[model samples]
Target chain A: MAPSIVVRDVLDREAVRRSVDTALADFLAAKARTATSQPQLGYLSGLLQDFMAGGKRIRPLLCATGWYAVGGGEDPRSVFQVAACLEMFHAFALIHDDVMDNSDTRRGRPTVHRTLAEHSAGRRGEEELERFAHSAAVLLGDLALTWSDELLHEAGLTPVQLGAVLPLLNEMRTELMVGQFLDLDATGGLTDDIEATLNVNRYKTAKYTIERPLHIGAAIAGAGAEAMAAFTAFALPLGEAFQLRDDLLGIYGDPGTTGKSRLDDLRAGKNTTLTALALRGADAAQTARLRSSLGNPLLDERGAADVREIFEATGARATVERMIDERHRQALAALEDSPFPFAPDALAALEEIAHLATVRNS
Target chain B: MAPSIVVRDVLDREAVRRSVDTALADFLAAKARTATSQPQLGYLSGLLQDFMAGGKRIRPLLCATGWYAVGGGEDPRSVFQVAACLEMFHAFALIHDDVMDNSDTRRGRPTVHRTLAEHSAGRRGEEELERFAHSAAVLLGDLALTWSDELLHEAGLTPVQLGAVLPLLNEMRTELMVGQFLDLDATGGLTDDIEATLNVNRYKTAKYTIERPLHIGAAIAGAGAEAMAAFTAFALPLGEAFQLRDDLLGIYGDPGTTGKSRLDDLRAGKNTTLTALALRGADAAQTARLRSSLGNPLLDERGAADVREIFEATGARATVERMIDERHRQALAALEDSPFPFAPDALAALEEIAHLATVRNS
Candidate 1:
């Protein structure tokens, strides 16, 4: 195995971390300038910035770290380019996801549509306020997606490496699209069975959030299939745990910590496993009330409280927690069978991170 | 110049033309193979076919033609790939446009969101039918867009070409988004002067419909600035003519030929140059009545006729027609100024086609 893993304290990875941030910031700065040269460019760029401003730097760091992991000898700048690509795609998903969920806020601010709608409403024009914002946001999502591809292709990756990774990115997007659809479907009527929902969760969240980043980084590093397979196996289950844990947080966590509305799923009527299980096991009366409350935005403090009561009464939260725990265990088990003889330290460190992510305090 | 340009009919333009029937069939075949692989893939894929299946293939053909126009060597397959990219982008626009317009029908079929909503109403026990369709269609649009970037990057474009063109594609989408904002601005209040309206028309319609296609083709052909400038000069006015003709047809042409309701703009209270002109010149009563009838889907035949009468009395229709003619002439004049020297026969033929585009048989 190549000697590229940069294992130390997460804090100590600052040099690599700074490189990742610089790469993305430079790209965004340049891209944003160009994007705003035309009229109303300010609005779109502002939305883009707000949608993508800061994160745990998890995906990009994984990209850079994975590149380093596989013994890539190149400048880490290129890895940051790849990382930027990953984040741009993530931004694309978030923008569209917000619209799909009729979500009002993101990252602790009003969402693009919500903001636009509010502004338009203040001006007393629905045409300017709602549809324009939604449509433009949709277009901006596409623009970000195109930029992700642009950054990847121009990231100074070798032709061979670029070629190898292009199809994966393509498949990644397709899979994410499918996963989002499955998620929406599962919400509506539970047309997909439990297996289907899990698969969707795995593909949409697990793979995109973790596996694809690692695979792409490994590609840049020229890692072999054995490494990729092991990495994917490890990442997928970990990713599932990540999302399932998020589902838990969405319900029970404090809003200030997660920076999302507590129990938003109840308001959105998202048919999460927690919700689905609650619906399945509830008595007819409970089920009817739950159905009516699925998207009752007017669900006031009492409404949110009453809904939480039903969730606890149904024991769905426990079911979700159990699922999360199982996935976490599976992810760690995959790492145990990992084939790499290199970087036991990094592997061990990753296992620790997975645990923290799944059993997140927030 | 390359030898392929004059090889055959407009349909025979190796860069641009294909049998519409054949391409649609191919799109369907490719689309079918996609959705069945995952849970929600089928749902989104079907929505794409709904929006994409019926266009005149003009944009795709232009994409192909643009590839050929710059003296590139003949390769039908490559042009098809390029053309496919344009159609995919257009499909993306249509899906979102449907939502923006609150449009119920497109190309003699139900629009994406409306169809989803209608399907929900049909399904007896389904909850949130409108939400289901909107979410489904948004995901579908994302997939088509995602597919477009994937297809283009893998289109065997060189690094330099990809660098130049992919960002162009991104910029174009961004500009279009900005244009959409301007469109909302103009339509919401109609306070913009006629000049502003014309500029809005140029950005929103001409650039999207014509100039971008020409640029896309030139970029593929590796056209230098001299070539690009010439191409843009040729396309801009031609594109304006195309859109102005559309505005005219929206009100005056046969519904059978246009495949939309006659004077549909009048019924919808569209804020085009025609309407802007009418509104500017109209008295209090006419303006008030015009506002009421716009976008009212339930407007009866009599109501539509009243609006049309107001349109004629205002002389906006004739004013709009004259503007269309002026743009057509400018387009031809620009062709004469093009730096490339093709055969007089070719020039004459193209000139004739431009005339055919603007002149009505009736």
Candidate 2:
């Protein structure tokens, strides 16, 4: 029997998410089917599928929105496929990030390395098995990266579209790596350099998470230079606001709602703008407490509470909230002044996205 | 004054290596120049440059050869750039492999992780420093992988050339990853499954090292089906023989000549065909001795001697030699009966590569 058809509106967030999910599922299914001789590939593909199921697909949503913002063409199939590629690339980034952070859980479940280690419980010594799991997870991340490229190549884009998109995609990948390196270099060291933290955010989040996705989608729709610049203006501030919300949530959000441990960022000694601002405003004793509590592997709930109290006492928390508000306003202003003349539905969708990104708890 | 021009012949192995090296150096130099704002990138690029200087450049040479074998066009610049891309990809693979194996050295120098760890000395505790180094090395490897793609995208190939090469490149990447997974899955265990070991060899070495590179170059030259098939037939057996020679060198070659510790493969208990054959032909006591010595981290020179004796006594070493000989002969036979009409110089170069690959001491 033929399947029931679901008419997907590009402006409908739920529909966009569902469409991207379907595209991703179909792509992975083909991969798994073709990997009959390599059973490990089938197994890895399943792992990736399960891992992907929990994502919010924010990048894909932005991509589709950006396409529409630039007066996208009739067919949305290739747009959806490219969106799936971005999601796959994200999976690669996250899998490697977890390995680097030595994180145990993601999305309220064991991380990829932890899952693999658990799967091989009795097959080898604990240490050996853990090492193997880490190595295998790295390989899996590489595969995801490779497959992301494959998805884009097979996304049915015309030569002109491919040509336009490839350079931006390359830039995005390199920028993310640069951001990751900066983040890694800054880890384990407490700093009061708010500008440096924002620099990291600009590359890691502003460009990678928001701007590039928008550019890629717009480019697919044959966006002009003015439209691309408009995307950057709208994207950068909103992306920063999104990350600021994420940092606050990392320390304050409810575990059940966020599906993440509040302590992970603190435990990793992440030098977020919030922490940097807090350090900048801290008194001597508060600074000492911040230094000891952050990046401590054995940091307890009591320690985190101490940190939150210090953040409040130093006015860092208030400052970050203010910063998020300012950025959100800037993003909206860009959209209002946009020279590209976005359609009414696209404009509405982008406004909603900017609002949700800035104010969301999770 | 103009620089002195050196005439380059693709069939000349040394000239091909030089051209590929020059291409890679130029690429990395451009990357370094562009990364002025990101100083870490410049530093990482320098590290990669040093790492690359030590490679054999075999893959690039073979790629160039394959291009010529199928009647290449006049301009060799794009071929060299693509060859550089392959070499860069190899760097990514080797960097990750060293991390997975926890190897200390490559080409008589510290491995990337070890070098990074040493560089970070005195900045952190030993364990933390080691962890950071490994993570950083993974990121660096990722950069290499990303840069490899950039190299290909910027290689100035016609759309038709790119269309021909991309699928083969993708398949090569996937094949390498699959081979790596299989090899990782088999580490730390001694098995008597000769066929299984050869399966790993076929993927890890045969296709990745030889066949796919040839296919990519041949595709760039728009090789007909008959020529592509002939390259595969010549490649598979020759690749297998090359790896078999490498296996012997890993266990028996002098450290001075091979620039690798002879004890590493034995200590890792690699499930090579030679080891598998030895297990298959071993007596009970010999088998027990083999099991104990192989994969033992503390295996010493005396223990290695014992394993070597077992290999000799069971004729496994001899059988591997015979296998290498047979494979080498088969590759030559395929070349002799090649369906594509090869130029005399190209045919001569392929024969030389085959002979040197199977019989080289290093």
Candidate 3:
């Protein structure tokens, strides 16, 4: 076996991001070349390439960090390919998610469906155009997912690694869908079930956005049960903090800073834990106002301000802040409690991520 | 190496169907068990199981026949699981397609979106419920796709077999999406481009429904290039004939026999080869009537009767029938010209499928 590399050097965030981006660009470019027989396919590859350009690459970063923390036993080329696969999969999720929410913008640009609707301009009436745009976006999302599978296959994982990682990958996908279903089920109805909201959060973010990516990277490195369990312990709490902070950013962050409208979640009637906690403690009139205003399709900035005021008045905002702080602490403690002698730099990298996840504005 | 199994007994349609169905049921059962923490997951599993029960298993049958025709070198158990994966993938495609078309009935029962809408009734008003149903159905399709991947991974193919099959499987999915995009782009507009209609048919049916499944199954058995070329030559025309037959059934067949509303294609203004041919040969007034009546959301049986009359008057129906006949003949001819020594019973089976495909009413 080769000597273990220093974790921080292996997981240099800038290097990983550049490497993964290059892999994705090269892969899509090859797809475009192969699509020359059907030139229209080149348009799809271009759209996907542009849409993928602006993401933070958070999942890929975590995947690389996980691989490095497990001692980077495998060829970094394969790891980079898998990381690129995660990025493509994230693109798939976001495209479908924007359509499901009828979102108009993502990453400060028109959403995929919106762009398709514009592309389809002058071809149909309003209703037909809307239908075409939505359906076409769904198809695009499906293609991205299939392409993600292709990247994973082309990653050249050994059979044993492929076998180990596939189950976790499938579980991660299924769990995200389940979380989405539950979220859809809960929308349009105000609820005070904080525990239920937390369950959704855990499934949607805690496992999907964090634990599974880490586990997949570790599995690729042939990490054993003890190391895997350690990752679970470290990832779950940190992941929850990640989502809770996202909810906070959705409502309270500056649009210039976050590149998202603070009012969209409130307008969409998202039943986040913060909202549930506020509903739990609200007086009758507050509850009535929330029920009428939260899910209104035309909710404006004034409406959002009112909702935020209620959140503050009920102490939901402060309570959530406390929760994030506690989870962040728990996540850092998990690294200290890990079974393996984790490299000093790996521990520091995770600690920094925990801080950024909980304390940052975006 | 062990002696090869007899092809005919291995591909006994009844035995293949029963085994594939059992694999699907067992897989779903295990999924249900794993979802004990969220009982709603069990409901999704049950809905999928029920939706899967009524299909003709055409793809799985073709796949099993492909493997058997290649001499059944591997364990039949693994082949059956992969066949089941194709069926589940088909389920995913159908569920999303139905949502796109907004169809109410399939296989003599309410579509997945309809069932979900009915299940979600009493919780919201009409429009919200409709949106919820559509979104949830899309999520369900995503789940089915994920589960299909799980099934493929669990099939226990060697690394080489997996490597060979993955690219074909990915290509199959991408081709289907491309065809779907083209079909969506062409809908709501009448056209006389016969070649364009055939292009869609080649991608959507010839490749997706026929060629890829055969290639995947043959790849699993380590079949040589000559055998694969033969499968393609035999599959493409046969698949085209099958789709052409489907077009005929969509317009003229009995609802009782076909289990589909004969008027849907006309109502949706689907630009099939039949419609293209009809438009190509129609006089001015006849063309005007088609433009006005077709794609009218309120198109009824009376309008459909007029369309059918025009189809007959323009000889489009006859032309389509002739096309199916020619393609069916070409398919049989290709089988007869195979480079390898094919099993006698396998040739007979291909002939039977060709006949059933071109001559069927439903």
Candidate 4:
């Protein structure tokens, strides 16, 4: 059987996000019912529900658009289920990331571990409470990962669809984990390796955030080799651009708008592409300043301002902005050259998402 | 086609164990080759290989026995692959369990987190290295869980077999996580609730180690309701007995034979059935001594002896042994009334396992 051509229609991003949210809500509610026998499970499910309520649903949007790009039509239920699965997987990733980074807040609220620790204040000694909170968060993350698989299994895919999708999903999970390891290894050790930093970004963000979700959705619709290639062509550049914009925002975005502290990346000494570039370009005095200022747990606003000045003086900020613009343009060109004849709806959505990702303050 | 009768031959327990180990080795070796691009993954794989070399292979044994109990034969390759998947999942569980318990050692070797900390000692400050090790071990556990799923996917099962097995796998994972949460919540608080402690043992050990693996293997062979009921009737009681033996060993077993410190459980204030029973039977002075001694991180050899005296005086030790014998008897009776007529080989192997699990000093 020949693959069907993609259909053209104006993409409704808001509508897609709403449908994905409803799928997540309905799925979690069902989980709540199943967890009635284990009362403690209710607390975890509630925390996960609260954590998920604040997501922008970018991956789900990409997934829905991907299905549309491959001529998928008729019932939208399966696609929505798979899209919600991605969101749940993201929650797992973020919760673990917060614990690893020892961050106190996420999305402008206390992080999962912090909230748990506070709740147990009267029950445990200070040191023991902190340990309990950390372990509980880790377990919760494990549950999210496990439940994400449940969502996929219950999505009602045919055997052929599952066979096509499982390998890609496995590969995506491994790549993300490996990327995290690289990121963890690089932390607290300042490096001037631009290529290495970019490599981490490619694995952690480019392939994971963009390519895999699109590929998974297209696979669900039985898209062929040419369509898959087109997705990679569009996804890699846009995903890299997305991370680059994130790096910029980490140092520059307003906390109220971004729902994250601007000082976090600096304080944690995250080895991002911008930092690598700046370190490579800095003079001896500037290098010493970066070395001393970064990774200081007690870094204050004055120290942060000095670090920002050095970053600007080294031209890192401008260079990153240029990188984002270049990748965004390349992504748009890839979309234009898609082999699927009726991919205009996907193209429109991709263009809008590209703008939102690269130009946003958050 | 009629369901084939289970064939009778005294099972080669050692041969099944060897095949499962080979499958695990080959799968992890392939993963090592695939992970060459990310050098850091090789270290994790190496650590995991070392960690796995010392395991008792209990769950894999049960999985294979379950298959044989339901007429599986003549091509052991797929069964071995699935059995290895169970072992890998157990590794994930143990690695995370160690991290949560803040354990310093396991199987007479440094725990994963402790080893990771020592490895990073040269690169980070003492406190910083400890935190890094904890986070890294958590990530490694996540990797182990993800790779276990990959093993299941690549096991080359037919679609029908996969459909039968996936739900059992999901349920097993969820049950284990809930069990962990319950255990975590009850730690460090003295409780006289024997039922609650037993509940933790049932979910954490019985369902996870015995029932689910059997159910998964039985499902692979398309066992009917009667066969499933027989397996559960036997599994639950035997599983509880296995854990009860473990609780006794934790306090009474020799360190040289067990390859674990006897005082670890008492010092951690574990709410085992034995401890709960002792607390219930203790007099006022005995209760005060129990509270002061248990969970004392610095509790030395003398303090441990005192705790042991209290356990004996309160009759907790003898009671736990009685519980084990009762459950063992029930499991054997259930086996005697097997619904599958040709399950003699499985029954023989299971009986031997029960003896080893209950009577061994280690």
Taking chain A by itself, what TM-score does each prediction score?
0.89, 0.97, 0.96, 0.96
How good is the docking of model 3, by CAPRI class?
A: medium
Q: Candidate 3 regions off by >4 Å?
A: A1-9, B1-9
From the highest lDDT down, the ranking of the candidates is: 2, 3, 4, 1
| Candidate number of the best TM-score | 3
lDDT, candidate 4, A27-56, per-residue tens: 788778887678777788888999888888
Could you tell which candidate, 2 or 3, scores higher by lDDT?
A: 2
Give the per-residue lDDT of model 2 (tens digit) for A7-52: 2366677877877888888888888897877777788889899888
Candidate 4 global TM-score: 0.95
User: True interface contacts reproduced by each model, as a fraction?
Assistant: 0.70, 0.62, 0.64, 0.73
Q: Give all TM-scores, in the order shown.
A: 0.90, 0.97, 0.97, 0.95
lDDT of 4 by residue, B1-362 (tens): 11221233215666667777887888778778887677777788888888888888888878877878888766656767788888988898989999998888788788889989888889987877887888888888988898888889888888888888998999899899999988988987878999999999989999898888888877777878888888899888888988998888888888777767888888888999999999999999999999999999899999999999999999999999999999989888888887666456677887887787677787
* Residue pairs in candidate 2 whose N, alpha carbon or C atoms collide under 3 angstroms: none
- Cα displacement (angstroms), candidate 2, residue B123, comes to 1.1
Which residue window of length 10 is worst by lDDT in model 2 chain A? Answer: A1-10
Badly placed stretches (over 4 Å) of model 1 are A1-21, A35-37, A126-128, A190-193, A280-296, A303-314, B1-28, B34-39, B124-127, B160-164, B283-285, B295-298, B344-349, B360-362
On lDDT, the candidate that comes out on top is: 2
lDDT of model 4, residue B85 = 89
- Candidate 4 chain B lDDT trough over 10 residues, lowest sum: B1-10
lDDT of 1 by residue, B47-166 (tens): 676677667666665555555566655544555566677777778777876666666666767777777777667553454676677777777777777776755764677777676677
